[model samples]
Target: MLIGEVARHSGVSTRMLRHYDSLGLVRPTGRTVGGYRQYTTEDIRRIFHVESLRSLGLSLRQVGRALQDPAFTPSALVGDLIRQTEERLRREQELLDRLRAVEHSAPTGWQDVLRIVELLHGLNSSSAARRQQTVLTSAEEMPVSTDMLAAAVLSESDPNVAGALRWALARAGGDGIARVAAGLSSANGDIRQRAVLALAEISGDEANAVLAEALENPDAAVRRHAALAVGGRGDTAAVPVLVGMVVEGANDVDAAEVLGSLAVDATLATPIMHALAGELTAHPADPAVRIRLAQALAEMPGTIALAELRRLATDPDPAVSLIAAALAGVLEERAED
Candidate 1:
């Protein structure tokens, strides 16, 4: 077959076939009387082989080496191609995300688009200060989409930058609650904690609902954080976890305070008291646990907590007795007033 016929059959363009010939990648096997290039069946087969390698993302040089070098093993080259393809995909995905963020911002002009782009770049910067400044300035100067803020909140490792992102997300209202909520299911424990922290900062039914869901998270820290946030919101659902926190001495003071606040509701007072008393009973041998529980009781309203405090005042452990006695004295003095 002549070069044109070879090109037609193989789907390799004539110019490309000539280029391949010049590079010795697939030289014509013969020539006609007019001196035009002519291809044998084997030459056409090589053209198809080159096209096949190109489809796998092989550069022309790599393709040539692959076909010509008898010792060239494909394993390393294939692995390198896989990594390169993955990197390209990652870049494309990032570009798509940026475009979506910009589109969601609803830019009125090129300036708005540029500003949004710059803000996004800053948010993704390696410098925590730049990320924090971007969030702070964007809130006042331009409207950032809740999606971007929520994403930043979830990924931010720097405490300062994370706080700014959370503040901006909270100010953005409940719009980003679902995105932040999705982070709760991440297999990463840190991400789940971050998700709960962000949810705590956001107010509204949506955030509260997500917080309630987070209360059951498998992670103990996530559960504790969610409990504190939801308890402060006056949700009695956090009672069990709050009680647990006091027993475990994990932020026991805050847990106790939230419980006391919940106890303000007349209906919750008795159960809250009983839950504390139950923990005390369950851990009788553990004086440290008992002492933390005794301290938590002081936050409860009504005579029940005072009665519990009075009983603990005579406890076996001197340290427990001393702390409980001090708390009991304070409660009695309050009763007198």
Candidate 2:
């Protein structure tokens, strides 16, 4: 095949084939009567091979080495290509996300676009202070998109920054609850905790509903935090977990306090009292459990809690008796006033 015929058949341009020839990548094996480059079957096959390698993201130099160097292995180069492609994809995805955030912000001018971009960069800064400052300044400068705030709060690890983000999310509340709810389903425990923390700060019914769902989360910390938040909202559904918290001694003091507050409701008071009393029955031998139960009884209100404390005051365990005696005396003193 002549040069033109080779270009036509191989789908490579004549100019590129000449360039390949100059690079010693492919050369015609024969000469025509007019001294034109005439390619043989073998040369045409090598041209196809070079094009195929190029399609796999191999550089021209890499293609030459692949074709000529017997020692040049494809495995290592292919691995590198895969890594390079992954990095490029990650960068592209990040850019797409930034563009979407900017687009969602609905910037009115190039200045608005610039400000949103700068604010986003600051929110993602490595320094916690910078992220916090960005959140603090966001409201004064302009309304940040809720999704952006949600993303920051969900992934933020720094306590101060996370608090600032959560506050901003609450103040900026549109779809914030829904976005944080997505974080509830994340595989990362820390992310889920952050999500619940943010949800707890948000005040609407939607946020409360998400907190209710989080009470059943597999992570103990998530469940505890959710229970505290929900119980604070006077959701009677949190009573069981709050009681379990008292039994397990996980934030038992705060859990006990919340349970006491829940007992203000007539419907929940007896059940809460029974749940606390039942824990003592379930673990009669554990003095530590008994002591914790006694302490919990002190936080509850009304004649029922007073009577339970009086009963516990005479218990077999001296520590339980002493604490219960002290708590009963305090309740008796308060009741007298």
Candidate 3:
């Protein structure tokens, strides 16, 4: 193609192309016998890319240097582009901050949007991990006012999801613990279960106390979850209470889970062993609960436990049997040393 064709495709004027050629920035592939500059497909591509870079804010000098640099790897280019993106995000954040002062979006605004955008700009694996840390720290420091948690949980967006989780963690031991725990206890099965699982992260006596109080909720769902959370916490003080629930339990599913999660002592060991042993036999029909029981046994593997497992090795569910056998061997080996 000629200079005019190259100019049309690259959005550079013919005079600019001539100037670039004079500077040795880009030269025509050949010259026709008629003395017209003839450009190649490759030359056009280079011009297009250079013009794109210029549009993206790089100086023409920088584009020329980049074209000359043979040492630039694909990885290096990607890293440099990422750095540029982060810089842009920072500038955007500054603009957003100014906008916030001018027109407040207290409950909802461009400020939060910009914050999330900045967080995501250069989001590599390492950055994502750092974000997880920040989310935790920010949650701990910020008061979990209603709007914050409401935004985080309700919005399925990343910043919102992360923000909500962090806020939840921060607000964990607050008075809302009672209400949230109540939600866990009284909501539909899935919501209740999810709430209790999230509540697992909660710490301190205040959290456990809230859970304990939930046991007295008029709703049976609340009572069941309170039992599980207490048992799972393995606070030996709650052992008597948990054991009562175990004895009178209607939901063996929950019972097995709570028991399996418990960090039992030798005192509770005998009872745990009895319940687990019975589960390995009587509930052969309930594979799920049986697996949980086996897991608990594995956590406290011993000679008697190994003997029980050795028998199960040839049983119907090879997975359960094999895992039990493996735990027994590992425990025996660990003890031998």
Work out the TM-score per prediction: 0.89, 0.89, 0.42
Residue 170 accuracy (lDDT) in model 1: 90
Q: What would the per-residue lDDT of candidate 1 be over residues 96-158, giving only the tens digit for each residue?
A: 999999888888899999998999999999998888889999899876899889888888999
Per residue, candidate 3 scores C-alpha lDDT tens digits across 1-337 of: 8988877876799999998898778898878899877998888888887887777666667778778888744466557767998999999976674444333324366666565444333221245456454455445543333333322232223553444463565454453345445445444664554455445456668778777665665555556666777777785444444433444444545665555455345666676666567756766766555555555566553454666666666667878777777867876887788
Candidate 2 residues lying further than 4 Å off, grouped into runs, are 1-15, 28-48
Task: State how far residue 176 of model 1 sits from its true place (Å).
Answer: 1.4
Worst 10 residues of 1 by lDDT: 301-310
- lDDT by residue (1-337, candidate 2, tens digit) is 9888888888999999999989999999888898876998899999999999999999999999999999989999999999999999999988998998899888889999999899889988999998899899887876789988988898899999888888899898657788788988889988998988898888888888889988998888889999999999999889899989989999999999999899888888889988998998999889899888888888887655888888989999898899999999999988888
Residue 136 lDDT (model 1): 94
User: Candidate 1: which stretches are off by over 4 Å?
Assistant: 1-9, 28-45
State which candidate, 1 or 3, has the greater TM-score.
Answer: 1
Task: Name the candidate that leads on lDDT.
Answer: 1
